[model samples]
Target chain A: MKAPDFSYFEAQNIEDAIKYKSEDDEAVILAGGQSLLPALNMRLSSPSCLIDISKINNLNEIKIEGDFINIGALATHSDVMNNDLVHEKLPCLVDILKMVAHAAIRNKGTHGGSIAYGDPAAELPAFAVAMNAEIVLSGLSGQRIVNAKDFYLGLFETDLKSDEILIAIRYPLLDVNQHLIFDEVCRRHGDYAMAGLMAKVELDQSKINNLDLVYFATGDKPNVGQNTAKLVIDDGYDYEKLKKSLASEIDFAGDLNSSSEMKLHLATILINKILNKLER
Target chain B: MSAKNSVNISFSVNGENFDDVTVPTRQHLADYLRSQGLTGTHLGCEQGACGACTIEMDGVAVRSCLVLASQANGSSITTVEGFDDEVMQKVKNNFLKHNAFQCGFCSPGMLMTTKEIISSKKKLSRDEIRSEISGNYCRCTGYQSIVDAIEETINEIN
Candidate 1:
């Protein structure tokens, strides 16, 4: 139940951290150690060195820059959940944050680490994709910004280079006429979602102008329900009939938590439940 | 500076400062605490799921097993044995009054998480309390007694 022997380096800054990564190909960055420590304890991953970046200055800040809210990589789920900026600017994220694992896990699990880990069942990555956020990656070469929809490639796979570190994520602010909903069904409250949805809708005079739905934990990546969104919006947000047509529209794959067929069935029920509340 | 396998760490536990103690970098805070004879912090599902190793680090409750001792080098940790406050005393008394445990393995971490909720000064509903302590799992007692105890404690304090 102990992590394997590995050298530790407490990085002084982003440059210093990238320098270490550049020097060692098998080094892993330690953000909040929520996921990495568990992997290390289970011996699932045996990196030669662990780079502790918790001490890096200016990496855990949440700031509102222009029309976007920028969250640093080291910002914990608790930080994002409790931040007034997040509540006022992106309440959809707050809704998802509240449902993220328990308080203790939220206290230690970081936003960047969660995004970097890229678990398809996780909330932050799904939220990022639904918001069309931007992921900022920093390396010795400099910084590059990738759209959230393109950041994640597959299960536990991301576009982040080995030598690059996720510095921050910028989410575009929701317009005054835009409304969002994030909901999931798990066996237990703190457990991973069996299937979830993060929906963003732009409404003009109670009529839907645009709608986007990102389904999580039902596929290899956070899948955008493009056909369902188009159909539902075209049907005037009438989820009653629209949901019945969604089983064939969205693609789902089975996992231990749920079966593919069940997830397809549950997605309709869950989306309808959320839309019902919105209508009420 | 050359990286050393073992580094000297200094931290405060229960209001006492122990400085410059050499420890392996990979040692978890829970294991380190137990090694120092503070066995109240129990370990269950060391992967941070069970939450038996929860402790207060700089006033935030965190799973100690997931946190490296080296990460807690400068942190002030308060374990279950060192919890001495009026609110915690009330909580402890409520646990006894409510018979909150059959097996004491999860008590220490449960109490730590409970303390955090009380200190936060929120008016959490019954379901909210359950959600708040969902991280701490108790195999025995079916958790109703624990919830009753917490609610009773909050009601008394208010």
Candidate 2:
């Protein structure tokens, strides 16, 4: 399939990319092209001009800047795994990161690109939301930061303006006492998760302290399940009690892969998987 | 807009520089590379779901069919054909040892995927290795052998 006719300009840096994008009304930033490329080829989106931003430096680094781990927008999945900060500080991020499609696609796909692509089934965004991470977006006039909760409006939609390019995503570090357990059910090993959950829990003796749950691929948008998290904390020690809540109260939805009932069932199964592991 | 049809773009395909290729803005990197006689990169799903068109551009592996030819200007590319790296040979041996290829359409992309993994030297567990190769789909249902191949290759390299 051929994309619609357009002009391409290789931006020397992010400034040039932003400048060119600001100057034109119909231009889109090209990163890994994992999602955008397929969309353009499938005739889903046809921009008048393309701005390639591969040459931008430092946009691919995962740095520990004080209390937050700053993941650059251009940072590839391979880069994330290689970075010492991410591996040490937020290696829980690795569990979810490792679940992305394949090595080839991850090497080309970027952190900002996946968050920008806003695939509800994507593990990263769910992680971002679970961690209450914030996105840094830069447009012609200035830059704005939006929490992951607000960044996602709908399926494949973000608050980003076409003129703006996402710069990075930052999240506060979880405490040493916190244990994270992530579980996703994919048709196969590497495909998009049919249903996934990233849960952060802290146990005080035998009682659950905080049972925060975030699930993806269950609906058109990620359900933070703040209520479910609270309920899990209150009744979490008994896995069966929380398991029933996950199945009944979570209210999961589905897309092309499964049904609403199936999504909900898978979500509960995945949540149980996490709870069981951490319980060990 | 028809007047702005042709744009000169440059990309390094199979580790060689071809700075004079002028392609339509709509042309895909997969098409451009194949047109340049680098037919090693196979095409399977035509969508991002399959890794058949996997290639490294500017050190990052991407779906060639999804990338516009113009997007790859000044980028370095690596493909399966004409690959002679030791790790690549080891990956081939892994496939041979495990007999991973049935249809073989997915093998080229798998090799490319494995190439990216070995180059980084990132610590990979069995679970990570399995997830990393998930982008490529094999219809022959030979994933066990495929994973075995990658594991063997990884072990040989160490």
Candidate 3:
């Protein structure tokens, strides 16, 4: 299906994008256009105008500042995956990004667009949650930061306002002691996961000190397995106990491809899989 | 087309320049390419799922169906028809030798993706080659021929 007719505006800068967004209530920000264009082509979303922010200068920079790795909103998936800084600072992200869509889509899909799209089945949103990344939103008033966990409201819903644009995301530099492990069950390599896990762990003498278990495609948004994480941290990797606890803690939502039972089963398998990897 | 619906875009397609051409804002790059008689860029699923409409924009492969014609303004596009390089020629020869495609519906996208994989210059294993071209779905030939073709192409180039 073809996209509905709309007006297009190429923003020269962040200010221009914000101004354009503020002027039209039905305006959408066009970043890499990987996700937005598909939605537009399918008519799932039909904005009156698109503020093309792809050409905005410096919005695609991936750099380290202070204690955080700041990924500019325009940074494409390929950009993040292939960056030297990202490879050095957040190597796990490179592995996780390889599983995103495909090479062609990755070349055009922006990190901010993926997060802003807030697909429950996507890897990046859950990654942001596990890493406790800070989302930067710019609007007419000023710029404000939101935690990745709070930024996502529900499936395909985000805290992004109509008049605001996601400018960047800041992920705190991973400590030398910390390790990030990610795994997902996709029928095919590039398809959205049936269920996925992004676990950030800091182990002290092989005991789980800090663990952040974030699951995708199991709930409306990236569901943090807080209770499950607590249980694992408290009791170690006891498969039976953790499985029981996970069943009670995480609420699985069934989609067209997988059932709630299947998601729960897959989530449990992923949890055990990561825990075993940590032990090794 | 009304002024509100149409956008003036200038882009280079297959080394040819199109200046100030008016296209509907909703028209996708694949459709626009086909309209220009570069029908090699096929469209299977308009959504991003099927990579049938994959093409090179600004030197990187992207799904043309997922990119609006307006969004492609000022960019350089290369379809399967655009390849005249030695590597692409070798790749084509390998596909022909291996019978990489059956109906050839997915051939354009497969070729574009194959070109990218070979150009990456990575020492990829058979599994990696399979993973890299996973987006382009070929309903015919069961993909073994495609994989074999890509493997031989890489070996020939190296």
Candidate 4:
């Protein structure tokens, strides 16, 4: 598998990377290159230039700022899984990370890279949306922050401009009362999830205080179960009604492996299972 | 913005340094290593599914097919041959005792991953060993033997 020819530029800093991208009409930013390289080799995308930002050391720190934990764009999935801050602050995110691809891939794949790729089936993007994490993008114009809900526009697409580079992601620390649960049904262990659900629920002594459900791999983008959430909270956490309401609210076109109706059914099953687990 | 179509890179492989080596920017690390007469790294699936191209980059296992040669410039890499003989001696003995392989296409990559698992020094169960080598596809053997071999090696180490 040979990739199309393209000029490569190793950027020293964020400014140089932005300048290189701004200059080229067909340019792609190289972060971990776990996703982009496979695309390049398969000829799915042909760019005139590749601005490699993997060398910039400044974009590789995982820090905590007050109430939020900041993760650098270049931080690998392995980094997130092993990072003490992520494990202590956001164990749900770490749980999702374990289900991603394989150990070797995670050792090289980056967190922001997967989110920027905007794969609807990817766990991180849906996880980001459920957590309402903030995505940081840097360009020649300076830095701009976009909420995770607004970051993903559609399938394999993001709000990032061509000349912009993703710098870091900011996730608010989980609250004491908040419980996050994630579940995904895939054909194989490492394969992309056929139907995945991640939710952050706040319970006030058995009464649902707040619930946010995000579904992936079943929609064009990560679909927030807003109406379903409202139905559950307003209806006093009725599981049966929630299942039926959720099945009707979320729509997905199944692929070769499963049917459209089956995908929705799997989503409902995953949701019910996760909610039931949370009750304990 | 002065990017080069083919760039010169410097990297160390198997304890040897190769500086000022020019390669196509689009070339992957697996292809580059093969070009340098290091065919131990197999290219099972360039799409990063099959882990036949697994290699050690800066002391961690990574899929070489997904990593570009240019991206690995100035880094230290280790292939199957770079793996120490002392460690592999025990793995090979356990593999033979368990009949770990058949066609041996996935051996080099499997060995590299197995090396990583052993070096981690974690007490691994059979299921955990199976999970660690899940990336490396072995069609010849039913993987039971492979898991047995790895499990026995872990036991020996502990």
Candidate 5:
């Protein structure tokens, strides 16, 4: 059953969407409706009006404008999967996205919606943070860009104002010599992750030049599990250290499927596993 | 949230525009489309779990049960019935040959899903087909034939 209604305005565009925002502080912007509908049905949110922003054309843009690839917040997971530009630019995103919900859910769930909802178990923000992506948000106040690393303030929290909507996400294209890997564990495919890793490492002369490993479903927040990255980035970085570090990484979340101790065990094992595999 | 102040909602379903009567604000797209007598889009496990009420809105497939009719206003929606064209014919033949469905409760969802995959024109591998349709559940068929059916449809279409 649908939730009780208030008012509805099919916003003509970004400007129109913003207009509806002014009338109702309680107005919720409806994009793909994948997250919003579920949130409303769960009674997690009660907005007086729904500002349907699906009509805002430019908000869905996904293209290469130069050094950075701009992924519009409205871009669906399928849009990420299907686009040659996305595939060409960020295959790690593609890998992570493949594990995000199902074809049906991914077909309509928007990039912006996921980031805004800021579910700690979500894949995009972690990927965004790992990629050093920049978030762009707009409201009646106008637009602003936020780095993904800084955007996530806490679990299910971001530096987003109620009136502002995420406009786009921009990330640098991977340099040719760079390598990227995305891996996550879930009891079932398309469900939220039990644990996820988005890693990008730049290697030179069999030593680490830049080692960035981000862990999600392993923290209260969706941002990088900094300790895991710190373990590998220090001097004398190696598979041996990474393995030991993974074991020691704090708060490896435990629940129904796996225990906190087990996640730590897996992280330790995988850090060595991934780093070793990166060698050959 | 009352009758005195009503909201008009409209969108396309199965290739036809439906400027339907005012429904309560909370009415889900799945229920609204179903009540309007488009039964091809079935309802099962009203939550996102079972892909029973799947529809393509704005060229993307999603669970109708999870969407508000108001949110879908002005968007082009294609339900299972809308797939009664060539793509589905290919899908149905492939399913029949492969014995893709037994209970058939999942058939409508399967058809809607396979139609999207087949229409994509991409060379989808067995794993890709399996992953793409992972959301739809079929207790009886056990998925081998379904996988074969989709793979067959993909090969034939592409």
Candidate 6:
């Protein structure tokens, strides 16, 4: 299917993109175009204008800034996957990115675009929540930062306003004792996961000190298992007990492939899998 | 159509420069390439799922079906017809030797993605090769021959 006709404007910088977006209420920002183009081609979305921000300079940088790693919005998944900083500091991101789509898609798909698109099945958003990442948004009114947890509202929905542009994401550097584990169950290697989990664990003297578990594809948005995390910390890590408690914590949603019950089962399996890895 | 619905883009395709080419904003890169008679870039799925329309944009493999023609301005693109290097030649020969494709609709994308995997210079096992090319579906060959062909090419190159 061909995309519907729309006006296009190539913005030279962030300000230009903001200005162009401000002029039209129906204008949509074009990042890597990996997801948006597909939506457009399928006619699922049709906007009056497309603000192309791929050419914005300094909008694709992946660099370390003091205590956080600042990933520019336009940075492609390939760029993030191959960066030495991400490799050394956030290896879990590299691990999850390997399972994201394929090489061709990753070569063009942007990191911030994934978060902005707010697909509940996507791994990045769950990762952002697990790592306590901060999302930076810019609009005509200046800029504001939103925590990754609060940024996601519902299915394919985000706190991103139509006039605001996602500029960068800041992920705090992991402490020496902290470890991150991510795993997903999908039909194929690159397909969206039926259920996935990203866990950040910090162990103090062989006891779970801090545990954060974020599940994707099992709910409307990234489902933070706050109660489950509390259970693990309070009662220690017991697979049977934790599995029994998960059903009540997360309100699993059914999809075309997996039912809500099946998703809950898969989510429990992922939790057990991640916990085993953390114990090792 | 109004002038606002179209964009003038200049880009390079297979080492050939195209300047001031006007295209509809709705047209994707795959359609744009086909319009220029570069039909080798197939379009199995207009969406990014099927890798039949994969091409090299600035030395990276991407789904042309998902890239807008207007967004490709000033970029260098290489289609399956652009392969003339020794490595690509060897890859083609290996594909033929292994009978990697049947129906041949997926060959261009398979070749383009295989070229990328090989160029990565990583020592990939057969399982890794299969995983790397998972995006490019080959319904006819069942992917055994394709993996064999890519594995042979990597062994030869290494």
Best candidate according to DockQ? 4
Candidate number with the higher lDDT (3 or 4): 3
Ranking by lDDT: 6, 3, 4, 1, 2, 5
B-chain TM-score for every candidate: 0.96, 0.91, 0.96, 0.96, 0.91, 0.96
Candidate 3: where are CA atoms >4 Å away?
A238-240, B1-3
For B11-36, candidate 2 gives per-residue lDDT tens digits of 67676888877888778888887887
Q: Give lDDT tens digits, candidate 2, residues A179-264.
A: 77898888876688888898877778756788778889987667777766886666554456656666665566767888877877
Interface RMSD of 2: 3.6
lDDT, candidate 2, residue A254? 63
Report iRMS values in order. Answer: 1.2, 3.6, 3.5, 1.0, 4.1, 3.3
Distance from true location, Cα of A41 in model 2, Å: 2.7
In model 5, which runs have C-alpha deviations exceeding 4 angstroms? A1-6, A19-25, A233-249, B1-6, B121-124, B152-158
Q: Write down the DockQ of candidate 6.
A: 0.63
All candidates' TM-scores?
Answer: 0.94, 0.86, 0.96, 0.96, 0.87, 0.96
- Which stretches of model 4 miss by more than 4 angstroms? A235-251
**Residue range A184-263, candidate 4, lDDT tens digits:** 89887888888889988998987778999999888878988888888768765565776678767766868776777777
Top lDDT hit: 6
lDDT (Cα, tens digit) per residue for candidate 5, span B1-158? 12222567787887787786586667788888889888878877766777878888888778988887767767898988778777788888888998887888888887878877876799988888888888998868458999998898888877
Across the candidates, what are chain A's individual TM-scores? 0.92, 0.90, 0.96, 0.94, 0.87, 0.95
Kindly list the per-residue Cα lDDT of model 6 for residues A1-280, writing each as its tens digit: 9888898888887887887787788888889988888888889998998888899899899999999999999999999998999898888888899989999999999999998988899999999999999999999899999999999999888998767999999999999888888889999899999999999999898788999999999999999988888887897667677777888887889999899988888887787788788777
Q: Is model 4 an incorrect, acceptable, medium or high docking prediction?
A: high
DockQ of 3: 0.61
Query: Which residue pairs in candidate 2 collide?
Result: none
Which lDDT tens digits does candidate 5 get at residues A192-263? 777777777887767777877777777666635456676676744465665566656555667677787766
Off by over 4 Å in 6: A236-244, B1-3
